[model samples]
Target: MKKLALAALVAVVPFAQAFDDKDEAIAYRQSVFSLVATHFGEMGAMVKGDKAFDAAAFQYRADSLAALSKMPLEGFLYPGADQGDTKAKAAVWENTDEFKKRLAKFQSDAADLAKSAQSGDLGSIKPAFMKAAKNCKACHSDFKNR
Candidate 1:
C-alpha cells in the first residue's frame, strides 16, 4: 500500500518536478549557446585587431562554432511547458514567427563565419567574424536575458 501511494504521488507530480522536457531543452540550448558565444567573442577579438590573429586558436574556435551550428534545430523548439530559467520572455512564444526568423539569422551568420574561417584567409575572416558578432548581438539584445 505504501509503495502504491508513493507511485501515485510521483505520477501526479508536475513534469517540472523532475526534468521537464521544456526545461531540459532550454538548458541544453543555453549550454551550447554559451559555448558558441564564448568562442565567437574570442574569434572576434582576434579578428578585430584587439588580439593577434592566432591561426590555431581561430581554427579551433571556428571548428567549434561549425559543429555547434549543426546541432538539431529541435533543440530550439520549446513547447511552452515548464519555464526553468525563464529568461526567455513570454514574447518569444507570442512572437513565435519572428523568434524563429532571428534564430535562422543566427544560424546563417554562424555558417558564414565557418566558411570564411575555412578559407584560411585572415582578411576574409575579419569581416565575416564581425558580421557574425552583429547577428549574435542583435538577437541577444532583443530576446535574451540582460
Candidate 2:
C-alpha cells in the first residue's frame, strides 16, 4: 500500500509542479528568431536598394537587431527544447562547444554592426552588415534548416 501511494504521489507531482516546458521554450525561441528575421529584412531592404536608405532608421533597426541578438541563444539552452515550427538542429543542444564558438562570433559580429550603424556611413554599415549577416547565415546553415 505504501509503495502504491508513493507511486501515485510521484505521478501527480509532475503535473502539479511548475516546470520549464520544452514546448514553451521552443515557442519562445521561435518568436525571438522571428523578430530577428523581421529586423534582418528591414536592414536588407535598405542595403539592397529595395527601399530608401534612411540612416537613422537603419541605425535604429540595426541596434534593435543587435539588442535582440543576445536573446535567441538563451532559448536554446535547454536540452530537448524541440517544439513548434522550428528549423533548429539537435546539434544546437548536443554539440554545445562548437555552438558556443559560433554564438560568440555572432555576438561579436552584431556588436560590430551596431557600432557601424551609429557611424551613419553607408560604406561602413554595408561591410559591417555583410559580416554580421554572414555570421547569422553560417549559424543557420549549421544548426537550422535551409
Candidate 3:
C-alpha cells in the first residue's frame, strides 16, 4: 500500500513541478493553496485537541502552510490570459494592487503562525492560526466566487 501511494505521488509530481504558462500557473497556485488548507486544517484540529497533539506534526504542517502561503499570489500576477477554471473573481484582476496587498498580509500572517508553531507552544498557536486564517477569509470574501 505504501509503495502504491508512493507511485501515485511520483506520477503526479511532474505535473506539479513547474508552472508552464498562465493557465498552468494559476492551476499550480490553486493546488498549492489546497495543500495549505489541508495542512492548516490538520494543525487546527491538533491545536483544539480535536486530535491528539503532536508538536512535531503541528510544526511540520505549519511550515508547509507557510511555504505554500507564498505561492498563490504569483498566479495573480501571471503575465498572459487566464485559461483555467478559477474561483478568483474579476475583481482580483481589476483591483490588482489591493489583491497584492491582501496576499502580502496573508503571507506575513502565515509566517508568524509558522514561527509561533515552531516554538512548540500550543497555547500561542491558536491565536496565531486564527489571525492568519482571517486573511484567507477576507480574500475569499472579496475576491472569490461562491
Candidate 4:
C-alpha cells in the first residue's frame, strides 16, 4: 500500500508542478502591472495634493518604478498565445517596432523620474512625473486593449 501511495504521488506531481508554474507566471505578470499602476497613482497623488512632500517616499517609489521597467519583458510572452488578461492590443505584435519604441520611451521617462527624485527637488519631480505619466498613458492608449 505504501508503494502504491508513493506511485500515485509521483504520478500527480508533474501536473501539480505545471499548474504551479502557470500560476506563478500569472501572478508575476499581475504584480508587474499592478505595481506600475500603483506607482503612477502615487505620483498623481503627490502632484494633486497640497500635503507636504516626502522625499524619501518619492525616492523609494520612484526607484521601484525604474527597477520594474528593467525586468525582462518575457511576461509579455504568454504560453497559449491567447490574449488572456493582457490588455495589450494585437497591434503590439503587428507594429512591433512602434511597440518597442514606446517601451523604450517609458524606460527613459522612468529613469529620468528616478534621477529627478534623487535630486530631492519637488519642482523637478513634478515635471519628471508628468513626463513619465505621459509615456505610460501613450503606450497604454496605443497598445493596450482598453
Name the regions of candidate 1 deviating beyond 4 angstroms.
1-20, 70-73
Candidate 4: give the clashing pairs.
87-145
- lDDT tens per residue, model 3, 45-98: 887789998889988998888878877776766665244678888888889899
Model 1 is weakest, by summed lDDT over 10 consecutive residues, at 11-20
Tell me model 4's lDDT, rounded to 2 decimals: 0.74
Q: Candidate 3 at residue 5, lDDT? A: 100
Q: Sort the candidates on TM-score, descending order.
A: 2, 3, 4, 1
Q: How far off is residue 5 in model 1, in Å?
A: 50
Q: What is the C-alpha lDDT of each candidate?
A: 0.74, 0.81, 0.82, 0.74
**Residue pairs in candidate 1 whose N, alpha carbon or C atoms collide under 3 angstroms:** none
Best by TM-score: 2
TM-scores for every candidate against the unseen true structure? 0.74, 0.81, 0.81, 0.75
lDDT by residue (tens digit), candidate 4, 33-59:
799889777867877775567888889
Candidate 2, poorest ten consecutive residues by summed lDDT: 10-19
Q: Cα RMSD (Å) per model?
A: 10.9, 11.9, 7.4, 10.4
Candidate 2 lDDT for residue 139: 89
Pairs that clash in candidate 2 = none
